[model samples]
Target: MKSFQELGVSKSILKALDEIGFEQPTPIQEKAIPAVKSGQDVLGIAQTGTGKTAAYLMPIFGKLVKAEGVDPRAIVLVPTRELSMQVGEDIEELLTYSNLRYASVFGGVGWTKHAELIEPGIDVLVATPGRLWDLYRAGAVSFKKVKTLVIDEADRMLDMGFMPQIRKFLEVLPVKRQNLLFSATFPEKVEELSHEFLDFPLRVEVAPSATPAEKVSQYYVAVQNYRTKLNLVSHLLKDEETFKRVLVFCKTKEVAEGVFKVIKRKSEGEVKVLHSNKGQSSRINAINAFKNGEVRILISTDVSARGIDVSQISHVINFDMPQDYEDYVHRIGRTARANEKGTSISFIAEDELFHKDRIQELMRADIEEMPMPSEVEIIPISKKEKLAQLREIDKQKRENDPDFKGAFHEKKKREPRKHPTSFNPKSMKLRKGRKDGNNKKR
Candidate 1:
């Protein structure tokens, strides 16, 4: 409960924080600031929406009070282009009264344009791994002056297969630099990365790994199929006053598009969809519109789960359960942010029940089950959809028990197949006569 000042934040940064309305430090910030300020490598484990961005940024900003040198002195590597921009915005807000220069670089856009932005040099650089490597190889950036490196969302970076690029950065950077790695969940791969990336780093964990935000009220509605899930979402969103500024998460681009079309047909407010197939400008516009409250509902895949930083999101609807259990935490985290209370509703279909169970096991808690509203019609599952669900359930069962063959396998075994012989009836008769004659002779 200590103030940012008590955490030994510099006066200039304190004024900026005060202006930004950050009065007290979050648990992660309170514990992480001092450790980072001491110039020790830090490994922080906290869930999303817990002020983890500021936890590392404030201390780094305090240390780099004034801009110096031509090349960047500090680098913050993120997993997605959206996160790079969001972090860049945060840096701009925190450096309002300071002279530090920064630039955010990422792919999906021309590297030449970003190169021009960093031409005059920067004190801090926030970048995605691929674009950073591209710029470095093209001689648009340098890592000689890097004194501090922060790998935010380490688990997400690993998820996106950025380990090779990260290793390259580590190999080229100065060995004496400070390393700060932060993640919402620490899977085994992330742990292994930390060992290789950090040197005697001090560990700081504010909460248990994979734990959802405490302020979010979570519930799930049992759905029969995809169409039923859509019906439930449309029904709930009818309460416009209560479901304002919501995010609807789907597991794939096709599902997201389908949800967007359905919601757009019924919604009175603005609706948008985001996924990998979206063009860069489209994705940016969708995110900006959602953030500015111009869009009421944003149907998206997991791309925006950790990238968005909006605080007033009223609800997060999981249209489809995430295959990865850890993603459930990030998906729900999109709603409740900056200590604001929010709601998360998940639609658990028959096949997704296994995923729901895995998520509960990761969170160590069960999501409250809510009864379906009488007014909302529950569509009967189609035969094809029922078969798909059965197949998925069988796959999940096989994963849990290798010896247990699925229903399809048992069905195939029960129906015997007849083999055709090459010999005709005449050849069979001749062979039988010869055998009988031999027996009589004996």
Candidate 2:
């Protein structure tokens, strides 16, 4: 029941908090502000939408109060451009009563304006890894005066392979600075990085690592194909009782586009899509539209959806199952946020049943399967057909090799890509084309 006032935060921050009606501090903010005021590194592992941003932000502002005007004193590294902007907005809300200035620098935007915003005293800098590194290498920004460093959503940085970049940033920055790492899920890598960046840090775990928010009611529906999964999703939405603000997850940009087209035709209105394949400006606009309630349902692939910060999602639907166990946790976490009850409905095809064991192991609970809805037609998969499907999958390896060109070229030295077991088999199936006369399965 701690208030922001009792947390020993700066009066300016308290004023801003009160003005914004954020009177009570969440568990993370209550614990994190003090450790940060002491200038100690803090490692906070908690679920998303528990007001995690304010947990690290208020304290950073508290430390930066040694001045009146803008001067860069803190650095927050995020995984994507959208997240960088979201963090900037959060900081702006917290510092409305103060004279703090923040610069959000990320790729794709014009460099001149970003350069002007970041250098020679921007006060607080929120940036994506690539843009920050580019600025650092170009001598446009300096970390010499950075008093605090925050790695928000540390798990995603690892997922996107930004560890080396993070390590490089750490190497360049002053070694004697306060470090904070926050994430919805704390995988082993997050803990390992904690030891490297934090010094006897005050660790805060408000929720267990990798656990979804409390408000979401979880369910997994077993199916046989993408079409079946889509049918189940459509049925849930059409069910009328639980169809508000649904967010759907797909694995790739191409697949997201395809599913979006299918669902857009299936739904009445309020359906939208966001993915990396779209231009950055379009993606930003789509997300803003979704946040503003213009779009009731947002269909997105993993990468583009990584930085979404919406808090009032009613349900999260996994149209295509994620390959990684951790991704599954994050996808479902979109709902049940901000202490509100949410429903996470997952569709598992029959062939994809193999992935269920791993997902169940991750959740530490058995996923209950609802019988196929009679009203929503579900086409059945015959055992004979499935066996024939497996045999075709087995025959594909020798028959299809795109690199061979004409089946007489020398072997290439390219290494194969690592795809998810569920999707990888499907990708291999596509690489092996159908039985056509001229269009051979090359």
Candidate 3:
């Protein structure tokens, strides 16, 4: 493996990297730095933990640090606020040896503060689409001086319906600027957008798109229901040796809150819940606590799965199976980062097995199933749980074979409404005659 210095990284930036204990470049960074430096548009395919942020940031810094710019030379577009913050922090760390201004602008916060920060001009601007667009409209940002435009997590941006905003940026920004599109997966929509956005881009991929990190040991435990899954999570966390610095992903905010309550009550360690329902400050606090080792467990929804950049995470627990198969990859990618071995344990109920099957199909590897721990008692499946399972199976069948509705699918029979005065033809004619007679008298 070649060192960062061998990749044309400057001594000053190398010093900063060394301070951060980054010695060798990861595969994505190793291959992408050159391509990014070459100034051609790049379509990079790499998972979250593959150092893709540094891949682009290194070359960007090498060029920007030498030049004097005021109007934001590089703009990185991220899908979520968390990602915007993560990428912004990476940029800050990379520029520790340089005197460059960078700001992370995202929603869930007032724009006035960000506007004030960027009004004086920024060298690097990391922002989400909505807030960036808002800033641009507010005349707080300028794209004329932007030399390089990066759309990180491009697939997620598309999934979140930021195509129009991205196109708006393309329309407003300088056409001569370089473009870099990075994503974990390139779905049809993402591919289509790349064609529209990039010009003859060099493609760099460290692994097949949507493939989970190989270092993550993935396993699933079958459970009876949500309660049992909670019990299992509580039981597993007792082994602090293996389940340190853990992230628990749920499919919904309510489930995440429930799991957080359960773990907080059962475990003696610090635990927090993160989701859209929580305030922005709370969410950020939860992430910081987890990252700083102040919190032992973080229960979150898919919102934080891909955006979190914490290192040394020992485990990722899927409290609920992700509805989107691609998310399973992102959830597990949270761990096994920085070439560290990590474990991913998923709690699967019978109803959620199909989701697991879809995830396995996407990864092209079946996760090993483990017997439930002896401490977790197998409670009888509740009727409500069984009905929910049936509904989920029905939903899956409908997705696969539209015509085959499951047993739980009962189309509501609508009773036709009856008009009080026009139930029959004779009554309708009499009403019409009375109306005509009244109009004639008037």
Q: For this target, which candidate reaches the highest TM-score against the unseen true structure?
A: 1
List the global CA lDDT of all models. 0.90, 0.78, 0.88
Candidate 2 regions exceeding 4 Å error are 66-71, 239-241, 380-442
Model 2 quality (TM-score): 0.84
Looking at model 3, which ten-residue stretch has the lowest summed lDDT? 427-436
Local error of candidate 3 at residue 361 (angstroms): 1.3
Write out the backbone clash pairs for model 3. Answer: none
lDDT of 3 by residue, 178-231 (tens): 999999987788899989989999999999888999899999998879778878
After superposition, which runs of candidate 1 have C-alpha atoms over 4 Å from their true positions? 410-442
Summarize candidate 2's per-residue lDDT along 135-244 as a digit string, tens digits: 77877887888878999999988889999999899888987788898987888988888888788988888877767666778787767765666677776776444577
Of the pair 1 and 2, which is ahead by lDDT?
A: 1
Put down candidate 1 lDDT per residue, 290-370, tens digits, no spaces.
999999899888965558888799999999999988988998988788889999999999999999999999999889999
**Shift of residue 225 alpha carbon in model 1, Å:** 0.7
